[model samples]
Target chain A: MTVKQFFKSNAFKSLAVLLAIVIIAGGLLAIFNDLLFVSDEERFNRTIEKIYGGSATVEETLTITDENGTFDKGAVSAAYKMSDGNYLIHSSGKGGYGGDVYLWVVVIAENGKFGGIEKVLLDTSDGETLLGNFRDSFYENFTKHNDELVEGKYFGTSGSDVINNVVTGTTLSSNAMCNAVNTAIDFFKSAVLGEEVVSYTYLYEKYVDMTQTTIERDFAANSVTLRIVMQANGIAPSIAFDVTVKDGAITAFEATKPFVQQYDETKIDESLRNGTYFVGKTAEEIAAALPDGETLDPAKLEGLGLATGASRSSESFFRAAAFATANFEAFFAPENLTYASYVDFEQSTFTWNYTEGNEVKMHIVMQANGIAPSIAFDVTVKDGAITAFEATKPFVQQYDETKIDESLRNGTYFVGKTLEEIAAALPDGETLDPAKLGGLGLATGASRSSESFFRAAAFALSNYTFYLTGGEQA
Target chain B: MNKYVKTAVDGLITNNATFKLVLGTCATLALTTSAINGVGMGLSVTAVLLLSNVVISLLRKVIPNTVRIPAFIVIIATMVTILRMALDKFLPDLYDSMGVFLPLIVVNCIILGRAEAFASKQPVLDSAIDGVATGLGFTAALTIMGVIRELLGSGSFFGIQLWDFKIGFFTSSAGAFFVYGMCIALFTLISNRVEYAHRARKARELRVPAEGPLDAPGISAKEEA
Candidate 1:
């Protein structure tokens, strides 16, 4: 392309504009970054204030890893090599209860072996869910754990207070803190001891399942415990269970994971009977019994009711038993029933797609991109610009549905617009103010309908990164 | 509509970035847990939006259309970096609460949204007002949502615990949804009622002139006899 043509060309125009903007923006940002940046010591001292309630001197930053992998439990901050021959590290794990759990843990290094954790501070910056008596007493137990202590009391008010092997007042929230502490301990084992990390296909906080069954020869009892979590709806809250197998016979079966029941008690009483019926049955017999694919006949399930939702969940149990029987004979028995490195069940899933009847653009639905769990949306785009999305669904604070709905459908203001054009659409000669929004006294005031509109637009744009032809899915 | 009045109204409520436009959601959803936090985030955002809008309006003629998005982004980012660092040094509590979202303001759609749509086409004076107006709208929405969430979730107005009674779930994401929905509903209801009242009053005034005191020549032309 000629020099003159290049300036007019889309490629050059796009690139030149981008580069010029980058240069100017980057130069200024660098200076601000330097000026705004806090020194490591100050940052550490602040974290230490929450953790130790005293000033701490961070010696240096260090990296640790082993055979399984580097310590990937959480994001570990500076290693404060204290005067007491201890290293204080601040770490954050993604989830325990509702949000993240940040902790300050002190570890001691002994002659190249994994030293135990000395102190742990559960940073409540993002808060934790604690209710009732244990709310005050839970942290006291954590404070009781010092470096040399091996056995510590699992804090819980009652026997039923424990959830997913975590003993605490609240199941999910308190368990998150437990997981954070365990992550710190695991990091010590992997980094300091240089021990080979446990290799497994799946990992979870509550329980671990070996990819294959580890069959054991008769000793005490020729039995293996298997944990399987599944639910009817693809996005349904998972239902976790542990099925014990002894000599190819299903012995013990219980739902160990923390979850509220979807099926009523009567249905559970009737459906869970599938467990007893399958006991002493071979994997071949169990597999032979199942119809294959997503459907299984309840009549074939021996008096199990298909009308209630219990049968579907019960099928999850039988499926686990069958997989166990086959894999049991394959590896667990051959290895003399020895398996430790557990892996999680990573069930493969694909996006749910749809094409509205007689519509030009495609529509796809997915979960909303926030902590608003279970909330979902439908994104419809034509010629790359978003047409609209159904934002008032699943859950929302829709004050005026009619107005919000009207504004959402009126996204044509962004028709054929580039993502750039769509993002910035302020009117001409308008000196806008939040207070005077309704003051313009138009038919409608500051409309969240527009925000919802753009949210759908932005969501649709993001999905463009993972595109597929529009068609109906069976 | 009067152009200046319309613009200010639009910024605050008509086309608000937070409640209306839905831009800069990262900060809105993450930071608006308390009233002070909402105001703090709002000021920080206002600073960037005002400066970015002014800068972009001045450079509007110099910059090319094809590269407008990038140019706007660059300007916004610089402004955000400055705001972020300045806040970190001066207002550490707000800075700590905001965390990673401090830097994330660069990507906030509001700043760039204005730069591309308003500042680029409008004069410097108008663009500055647009920035402040929109910033205020964002601040208002956040503060209101924050107030609702904080009150219900903590049973306290602004960290002063009024009672032991608190809905712990309200402090979580699920709670945010409920509070956000309710706030939006209340905001729209009150705003619409006032707007409707104004329209009704205007219509009455117009009808009065048309009624012509019930004895004007327009209505009593034949009755003049």
Candidate 2:
């Protein structure tokens, strides 16, 4: 039969054609549905990019739903910024305790500093303590400091306070946050900042002395050598000080290790290398680096080093130098300097002479880095010969605990002994008697035990004035 | 008009499309998870079914006798397509939730069965009445199923939480099946008794062995050529 005849003959043929059309159409629609809806991973990646300012190409993105088949997108949305920054920097983290609690987080970063944190959406309904409390605790901080959204610096308070864990609740979460922000800071500084900033010191002092001479040296050229001496009679022990180079250009500086026996070696070294830079050809050349129209402080020189990338260690060293300079001024040029009373000076000298006839003397001088406004000293030399010298000031000991302990424990305790001097007297374990306290009339001793030494020293020092006075004074 | 209204109302509620007659089980079971969802699915199917019935009735004479089912399906499917597009644009959420079941409404037994049995034989208005009654009844039954499922399982009446009780029997898939079975059984019991009573009274009044099969409510007898 012909095709037209076949169609005309049977109604089943028409039904067959109709069924065929429907099957084709429905099949086409089913195919279309699969294409339009994106897989879950793409959405997660996009969200992560928004928060961290970087792309996160995660391998897997799991869509979580509650028992009610509803999800809170807002809670998950908070993770966008933190994961991109620093801290919880793991590519991924396993959740706590159960299969239910799936959490991931990253420390918050902005403008190259660790500020806050972000956590991926968590699907924990079990109400378990460790994971649930951690999540809750984290949200609590995020909400409280939610207002303190500074661009950088993770902890709401500022600086090292970022490392402080949540006090009473969610200690685990608090520790986690601390870990994340700390990691972020390290990553940002090491990976992003790319330089170590350091600081240096320059100090000068003038005093009324029998010997008259002018001294000059270049610090950046490494031609200058600094030595500090101490004397008793200070207003405050360990008073804050700074040594500002009023003028000088810092042409260049390379790190140098201090003597093993030196006082405050770690702190001084750190200060020198990490503090702010003042660059120029002379002491006066460096002061121009201060903020415009701001006066440089000879006491608080380290404060200037707080700028971004400033070397903390170098700034601290410069501050120490500035203190020394001011104290030296109080002793040498007592009338020339203000804010400190006059003190005596002792002198010593070094020779730079080549011949007897055309000899030149290089003077090596030690002045007080006057953290304490007490003893001051100087050194003098002329014509390649040692010049007359005397300690016009009363004896001064540097009051460092190490020196006192070294001397007292070795039975060689003396009133005015410095660490260098006491090192010569110590004989291992022999304890000094009270009778040996002679000249200074004080038996400087080590702590009763190493544990309480600092506290005891602080207590003794705080009540020194009261002790000096009789019971009547109390 | 009075007889027509009575027939339509009785067909619509008394012999519901899903419960009493147990027709269109595929769409009924697939879409009834909530009252809103059930209504949306039911109304969509109703619009398609009624339109197809009216058009089929008007063209019954013109349609060649041999290829009637194909022509009827084509008309019904076309109407379903129109409903699908309209629902997609206007009530997208319901359209999405209904998924493939909305298109399946064309092949629904209630619609096809009526088009072949009633619409093909009756006038356009009568056919339209049958379509509405059947579609509304189907909608009502599915909506009840949806309401029961949502309330028992989620402690919610259509997404609004009512209470949370740990009555395991009520809040489960088994519970849904149980409820649906009970409803169908109850409908069968009530309708069967009603039919029996009506039959007994009619038989007694007539005092004969029945003139024809027309006296029966649900049972149908095939006529020979």
Candidate 3:
């Protein structure tokens, strides 16, 4: 076609129209983009307004560096001192169930010290599928227990006692959230407040064999004081004592006032209450002082140069003393101490047994929260399909145990499904799909226990496929 | 009645974007999780639809037919981007709550569908009316669905806790489907009955005789008499 004809053709008209529209649209958008542009400072002020309920100017941009100390689970990325005396910290928590969780934390500052967490908002996250499962109250928990968090009382180094409001199904995410807030708190203490960072010595109930309510350690003096509460059998009131250990020996043993008031005064021995015979004894001597089966005969108590009137009370005292001595040594001895937070797949064990007629039985023990062994199960696989699945040790946790047990112990959830199919149901590094989990009869409410069950099943299936059937390892 | 009024009525009721035409069901289902979300999303869409329809209608004669789709998309996308910026600046809470879906308004069939089906052929005045009517229709439908779902699923109405009783099923995607299906079914039943009554009344006004039984599709016995 000629040049004149080409310019007037339908193709040229279409191209001209599209080009004109694109230029006009782009121009208009560029103008509006400038008009409605949200600058970083403006965005920060907006977030502050939303969280703090009023806008404030930036007082200073605080610097976060290695001098603040390194955090294993998370780090502080940005910090800003607000004109209203609050510090806004942008932080991220690692080791989430899915990946990292990013958060914008507003730390309330008062008189050049950490006040509390004003608010915590999720800025963005990387592949945290179950992030939406958390409610607003979950974030509010940080603000609720700000003082405890600053003192490193709740989420300590040992990770035994986390926040009470940890969501049932999202333990890893909850832990990540705790780590993120703790990072902010730690940075505020070390960098802003110029104070020594607080560290906790957590001891689990399983290892201690008694409830260590409160523990205080004096490293300079090489002594530890702990209160142990033991629930007595039947309707008798629970007994409590404040036991102090100095250089691996019990130095002081005194019953709490509540224990003294509740216990029968006539039957109790003054020597036990006053630490007459139990003082200056080690854990081994303490254990030897108590008779076998936790019952000391009155005659034996007298023969051991101890008060004989309160034999039952003496037995309780000796047992508490033994636990106190052991826990104190464990606390000071780094080799014997096992931090609950460090529990992972390495602590888990998987063993398999083969029955007659092509049936293979696998036993798996796994930890739900890395605090302790939470679940153990046996799966019988025949021809690659799970024939029988039973909970050798039923799933248990601090909360939601009954629902978790009911869901985990339901054999029909796993039976009649092939090992590969069960294994493929849960992909690696992704949060559990609630719908798929529902199809597999896993309760989303009991997510931690369900996750433990899933990990155990995956472990069993991988082992059954690789070791028994000679398949390649996953 | 005026033709413009009739067109507006048609857009609002007969060609409702959510229930009748089933356009923009993605936003309808996704954002109807709460009444406030529904209202916020609905208003955002309405703003986009109204602006895009007017602009496209004005440029219809100047733009060629072959490149209409892309041209229409450019206009709609521009409008959506502007809406997003304005919301982010003025109403950050709504912007945060709407999240990705706020930007996804560009692809919503409601805007493009009206541009091609009505705005591209109609005058500017009529297209503007149609846009408002259709937008309001979608908002109404979403609000209704939001109320039902929020009440059933979250036991709240527009974020106010009425009671703690809730059926969590209503909050899931499956629940959205269920609520959408039920809303469509109920809307169809009610609209169909109203349409039949109006047609019978019109025939009576025209003094036309029924060719079949009164209960037959459009005419009733009383109107025939």
Question: Candidate 2's residue-wise lDDT over B41-112, tens digit each?
Answer: 778877877898898898787666676787788778767876776665455445545655777787888888
2 or 3: which has the higher DockQ? Answer: 3
Chain A TM per prediction: 0.34, 0.22, 0.39
Ranking by lDDT: 3, 1, 2
Q: Name the TM-score of candidate 2.
A: 0.34
Q: How accurately is candidate 2 docked according to DockQ?
A: 0.02
Off-target runs (Cα >4 Å) in candidate 2 are A1-474, B1-3, B166-172, B196-225
Model 3 Cα shift for residue A452 (angstroms): 34
Clashes of 1: 25
Error of 3 at A30 (Å): 1.4
Q: What's the TM for model 3?
A: 0.55
Model 3: per-residue lDDT, tens digit, A1-474?
A: 999999999999999989999999999999999999989878776667767676676789987786663565578888888888888888777656767777788888777877878888876554554443354657877788777665454442222234455655457777677777777777777788888874422322322213224454454467877766655623334567888899989889888756333765456667777877778887656645543324444554545544444555556666677667755655443221112122232323222222244455655545554333466667776656677777665433344556664645766677777655665656652234556564555544676666666655655554553323222232
Q: What CAPRI-style quality would you assign to candidate 1? A: incorrect
DockQ order of candidates, best first? 3, 1, 2
Residues A271-343 of candidate 1: C-alpha lDDT, one tens digit per residue: 3534666567765566554554224556575554555555555555555556555444322222111110110
Best by TM-score: 3
lDDT of each: 0.55, 0.44, 0.70
lDDT of 2 by residue, A1-474 (tens): 887887776565556655664575566445544443434564345335534446443333223223211221111212222333343332211111222222335545557654554543332223223331222344445534523434232432111113233523334333344333333333333333443311111122111110212122222232322222211112211212222332222333323233112233333434344333422333323333222112233344544333333233333333334323322222222122111112121232222222233222322222332342232222222322223222223344433434334433232332223323322222232222333233423323432221122121222222222222101111
